[model samples]
Target chain A: MAKKKKAFDKLQWIAAYKSFVLEKGELPATVRELAEMAGQTFPDFKKQFTDLRQLETAVIALYFKEANDLLMADEKFEEYSNKEKQLAFLYVMIEKAGADEVFLQEFQRLKKTDRGFAVRLMRFLNRQELSWAELSWGASTAERVGVNPKQAALIQHALSTLMFFLKDYSEEKQDTDAYIEKTTDVLYRLTDTSTVRSMVDLGKFLFSRRKTTFSWE
Target chain B: MGQDKIAVSKYQRAGKLVNTGAKVGANYMKHYAKKLTGSKATKQDLEEENAKDDYSAFSELKGGPLKVAQMLSMGDQVLPKAYVDQFALAQNQVTPLSLPLVRKTFRKYFEKDPLQLFDEFSTEAVNAASIGQVHKGRKGKQEFAIKIQYPGVADSLQSDLRLIAPIATRFLGLKKKEVAPYFEEVERKLMEETDYRKELQNANEIISGCGNLEGIHFPEFDPQLSTDRIITMTWLKGLSLNDWLATDPSQEDRNRIGQLLWDFYQHQFHLLRVIHADPHPGNFIITPENELGVIDFGCIKHIPSDFYASYEKLMRSGQEQDSPELIDALFALELLHDGDSEKDQATIMGVFGSMFQLVGQPFYSETFDFSNDSFFEKIYSTGMALSKDSSYRNLSARGSRHFIYFNRTYFGLYQLLHQLKANIHTGQWTFIAA
Candidate 1:
């Protein structure tokens, strides 16, 4: 009789990989260790990913890939404005990465202790995010707007909001909705005239001692 | 042409206000100067001309000025009827963002094109309001009415209101001090309205609060698709009051619809003490079944327990016609001061008594027929007479500032009921035991 197959799909494998790195506080050195963390054997892990390095790379790509899948699965995604698609993309990634206090703490710890690993991880993340920005926003529009600055600002914004969310998000209660709104504000301010104007006003307010009184006309 | 985006900058908003103020001032000066020079215009004609200028300037403004315009239009004592008629347009006849600009706004809010978010999002807006415009959209099988606020509305609200305060008080026919609390109340509620997430929370609470009430319905709000500036709720199918009236439904139809509205306010006030305060005709819809569909929760007002208790007591005093009880109630409401002289106290009561009498009229009846043109005419005439009465004019805004909204709510309800000509059973919520 044929051997029983493991239930480890690509998404499950990605989840297992994330948990393995985050729980172990480092990348898994071997497939056996990753499989053990995933509650499967080495053979089961090999069926999904070839090696530890490949699995790590897949984990990064999977963030956007899975997010894209979600966007596609949502019938309304195509009908949404470009901004909404971008927000939905970011939300799905953050949610998939397990936007919780524990995840935030572990990630912070990894960044502090393992400089080389953090650099490699962030480089991959930055690359994937840029690709998404270009894809979701459309190449022509993204090109005109200079996708790099927008992408960089958005990534930094997403991280900053995650840190803020960690302050309030806990095991017993998670205010992801609030975090989504706060983070979305950054995107809005960056792109919309109103929010951008407010940002400029805020900057002026901070810099000037006297309050500015502009005309109502 | 101006910035290619909704000019939500405080400087821009203030600029608009200043320019409008200057123009209005110039017109007033010119009118007086013209009158002194023996022009053919009567005071009524001059008033009409001034009203025209005020409307043109205020109607161009998108945020605070328009909100104040709507509020002033609701009060009979606040503005001349011509000005009120012009300001009434501010409630529903708002300019819309261009399609490209609309797409840009969506892009800013969602970071994706709106087309990619909904299954079928209309580029054309179905309706527009002072704060935002509404678009019809579909996600799979479900339809939604997505309200997207004009950009920068929330960010610039404080500054806009600051600029509007002096100008608005003059328009509302109240002293700055007298109107401050009401402005604060409006500011608080308007701030909440800009935050769609808060509206979502309010919607859920209101749904639960009024879920058991018959003949009233609320749309299901989708949190996943909602943001502070953008709200997505299930599409409520119905006609606005004007549209329904044009269709000429039967008197029985009108009464059922009217009863639905009455019960909604009564249930909300006596039990919840939380009201959907913006009862502007645009905020409600009459379904094919004559059910009342409440669409906006942007201006939900929660009455303080003390205020509710005191107001209830005042109503009771009116019912019993007890002078001492009325005085006690006014004191409780903080409308009457302990330091007031006996003569001043009597003057306050004399002014408030007429106002209270009009307010209490419906409550004294078993079934009040609002369709009686005479009832509304009497109320309006009394309001005009009292406002002109030098003694009443001297009475500063007394009582809790909450009464501003409290009175506005009943006035709005009464106005709509009168339009519908529905006979409603009143005196039912005469007492609140709690």
Candidate 2:
């Protein structure tokens, strides 16, 4: 029997895969080649990743994982409002991706090969539910309960930010930073219901103050 | 905290100006409509209404127009009293950046959150600067004040001025061509004010040059913690000049502080030849020990050698109504044009001569009492007369571009002293022979 294969850490394999791609400027042609380059046996590599496609997906997932881990590591992360939490995540991720030219180039190639890659990746990242406030409207009894609207918004924001980051060429990507700040502000403001409440209040005030006129017809 | 978004885009800012213009136009129409019916409304009433609308618009659009309003109001000679009173409120009405935006700016420059960089950082701003906001932070035993510039202020400045040009031309009742050079000078200085690195350099220069001036204090800046948009400096604990005045200090203490202020400006003007052009009360602080704390060094004007020589000559030729030397100096200073007809030249000289005599009174004497309200009243009446004089208005703004901030410095300094009501020896500087 073949020697019992050692347990292989997925993150270690992803790191090795990244170094292999960066050094050679291309992905290995086969899992065997990647495993050999990483100085690991095929059996151990197979235990961690089924094929090159899985490994490739894992690499992109690792980026998001690391960004999330960094955000979670911050002591103030728990205290931040949901909007701030989203902003911090975008800032951290964009800054990290911008600094890694090699990764960005690889990401571009992957995007060309798979048009749905970003959407699928965003969906995967959005699996974890956030504790967002819910909206409800009723008079004593609940008539309608609003679902959390942040999931779709955050996914859309993340994807657009990634696309913007790829094209942003401002010095130190400052324009991208400004874009993120402005868009995030507008997005959160759009979701806030205070404007709608104020509009209703204004409408009631106008109706109450309406002038009643009597004319002989 | 609630985010109060400042109008940053050129279009949004321009739209605000358009609104003000329409409102002002409406006010004029109303005034005329009332006048046609033989109503008792006067032009002064119209002016007061216009000034209120203009200030409301400027205060909303904070960066450039409000700054121009403040500068126009500072001289108290250029604008009517109603306008001066209304625009003076722009000094403290700047909107502050939100906490998230502040964090974003910090991350952009330092690649770390402000909380991570400092041992303790306040989420809320302590005070608002013209182009930025200041937050208090502490590291171990040392306290700091960090000024963070609002986003896109520098980029939007040109467009802001472009939008304000037509409005200013109409408001100041000057031809657009006449306002161009002065606006250009103001635009250049406003651009410089946006660069915190230049402010850092200015602070360092002033501190090194006047470090030994008694009873005057400058903050210690940390370059390592500073960036192009964020300035980190040691916090100077004190009340603003207005606040200090409200404390009901003794006349002796007031005179002491006033003397220090006078000497500070004199030293910078004469010896260093580079003066802090912004002498607004907000830039000053009175320490607990009654020492003067110069908090801001954002607007430093380096007097040109030629301008200085001519200015010195003009001051020395004082009380001589039409001496050739005085005319020559005035010509050199660009206050009188060579193309002016003899009558216009004489009229201009007579006006400037008396104006200079009254303005230069403090410098011409060993001691002067600023508490004498009649003196200020005379200066105000002279200014009002000049504003109303159709002959003076016909002549375009004749002085060199340097005169804009230079006159502002003196006017602001005089106003500060007047507010203090402090009598002190004013002829202490050697540049002027009393």
Best by DockQ: 2
Stretches off by above 4 angstroms in model 2 are A1-69, A81-83, A100-217, B30-52, B104-112, B166-181, B372-374, B377-381, B432-434
TM-score of predicted structure 2: 0.78
Give the true-contact fraction for every prediction, in order: 0.00, 0.06
lDDT of 1 by residue, B1-434 (tens): 01112333467667766776687677778778888898865666666676776666666656777777777776443456677678877778776654544554566568877778888988767898877889999889989999987655665566778887786677657798867887888788878887888888888877899998888988998887788778989998889886898898899998888888888998888888898888888888988888889998888888888888888878878544437887788899988988877877887777677777776788888888988877777777887887677876766666787877787888888878887889888767755776
Summarize candidate 2's per-residue lDDT along B88-142 as a digit string, tens digits. 8887666555565678788777888898889999878888866888999999998
TM-score for candidate 1, please give it. 0.64
Tens digits of per-residue lDDT for model 1, A1-217? 6565466987788778778766777767788877876678887877877776566656555645666676678765576566556656666665555544464566565556655653455455555634445544453333343335555555555555555555543322223433444345445545657777899999888768444455344
List TM-score per model, in order: 0.64, 0.78
Report the first chain's TM-score for all candidates. 0.54, 0.69
Across residues A1-217, which tens digit of lDDT does each residue of candidate 2 receive? 5564455689888878878877877768898888887778888888887877777766765655666677768777666766667667777677666667666677576458676666566554445332221111111112223322455566567668877778765555554655665677667777788899999998888787666433343
